[model samples]
Target: MTGALKVGIGGWTYEPWRDNFYPAKWPHKRELEYASRHVTAIEINGTYYSTFKPASWAGWRETVPDDFVFAVKASRYCTNRKVLAEAGESVARFVGQGLVELGPKLGPILWQFMATKRFEPDDMRAFLALLPAGEAGVKLRHAVQVRHDSFACGEFVEMARAAGVAVVYADSADYPAIADVTGPFVYARLELAEEANPHGYTDAALDRWAEAARLWAAGGRPEGLPYVEAAPPPNQPRDTFMFFINGAKLRAPAGAQALLARLNAPA
Candidate 1:
C-alpha cells in the first residue's frame, strides 16, 4: 500500500471522458476498466461538476479493483464560492455517499476552489463546520486546494489544523503556496499540464523530485512535495479531471506508466 506513494490518472481525462480516446470509436466501460488495470488510482472529477446516484457508486465500485483508490473533487457548488455557509444537507449527501461510499478505496475529497476566490476566515469556518467529521473508526483525509493565494497565510493553517483537514499542495498557475505547508494530514495534487503544455521536468527536475520523495520516504516532513505533471488547459483542467497534463491525453496511459518508471528507477 505504501511504495513511494501511489500514482493515478483523472477519471475523465478528456471531455466526454470517452472522447479523448474516441467518443465515437471506443466502448465506454472498457476504457475505464482498461485504464484501471494499469494505474491503481484515479481522481473523480465528475462528482464535483455533477451529482451521482447510488447505482453509479455501486457500478464504479464494481469496476475498480480492491487496491484501486478514487480521489473525488468536492462539488464545486458547495465549496467554490461562499456556499459552505449553507453546505447543509445537499453537501453532506455529496460527501457522505460519494466519498465515504468508496470505503477504503477513497483517497481524498479534494475541495478545489476557483482562482478568483478567497478564503474569508469566516468562509473557512463555515466550511469546516459543514464538512463531514470523517469516520469515527477511520482516518480519511480531507484536502482543500485553495486557488487564491490569500489562503496560504498562516491563518489558513490554523483553520486546517482546527478542523483536522489536510491542505492540498496543488500544482497550478496560482501561488506555488500549495507545496509549502505541512500538517497531521497531507494531500498533494500534482498538476502537469499548466506550465509549458508539458512540464519537461528534465533529468534535473526528476532528480530533485526523486530526492525529495526519497527524503519523505526516509522520514522528513517538508511542506508539500512537488509531483511532476501537466495541468489540463486554461479552458479545462478539472473538467477533464486527472490526466490534464500536456502532450498526454490520448496517451495518458503511457504518461502514467512513464511517471511510475521514473519513480521506481534507481537514482
Candidate 2:
C-alpha cells in the first residue's frame, strides 16, 4: 500500500495571499482556516523564530481540519550555533514548549541549519542523540535541512538513517539537494516557484512534482534527482510531506494548491 502524500506552503499568513488566494475582505484571523481547507498540510515558519503560548498551539489545532497536519520549524537556538552538540538544552526547550498541545495535528519538526554550517560527523551525531523520540506522549518525527554542500555525503546520510531522522530533500538552486530517503518518512522543500506564473510553477513542473510525490509515497525513488548514496533502500511505504517554500514567496499558495489538486485527482 502507498503512504499518504501532503502538499502545502510554508505558512498561511502572507499579505499577497490575502489579495490573491483568500476571499475579498476575509477575516485576517481566519486565514489559517481558509488555507488549511485548501492545502493538505502547512510548514509553520513562525515557530522557528519565535515561541508561542500553549493556547496558541491549541487554537491552531482547532482551526485546521482533522486530516490536515502542520510541520513545525524548530527554533533557531536549536539549530544555528557554532557547536551543534551543545544544543541539548535548546533542543529540549523547543521540543517541550507546548508542541504536544497540537497533538495529532503535529507532523515533523524541521531542524534547519545555517548556510555556513558544515558537516561534522561526531557533532551531528551528538545533536541527533539529543532529539527525543517523543514529546509528551506524541511521537515526534524530525527532519534536518542542511544548507551547505558539505552535507551532501554518504556519511551524513548514514548518520541520519541510523538515527531515523530524514535528511530534507531541498529543491533549490542555492542549496545542496539531497534526495536520500534516510528515515521512515520523506520531507521535501521545493523552492523554484516563479512570480510570473499564476501558479508559481509551470503545469509540466507541477505534474513532475506530483508524480515524484506519488513515487515517494509508494516507497520508490523518482528519477532526475541528486542522491548522496547510489544504493536504494528496502521498499516500504512512507508518509511524504512536500512544501512550496522560498522562491517567489507570493505564489507559494497557488503552487501548493495546484500540486494538491493533482495528488487528490483520480489515479
Index of the highest-TM-score prediction: 2
Question: Which segments of model 2 are wrong by more than 4 Å?
Answer: none
Model 1 poorest ten-residue lDDT run:
232-241
* Candidate 1 ranges with C-alpha deviation above 4 Å: 1-4, 13-26, 135-139, 181-185, 194-203, 217-219, 222-252
Residue-by-residue lDDT tens digits, candidate 1, 140-244: 667777777677666777677678676776555544544433334345554543233233334454445545444444444433444222221112111111232
lDDT to native, each model: 0.58, 0.93
Best by lDDT: 2
TM-score of each: 0.75, 0.99
lDDT of 2 at 19: 67
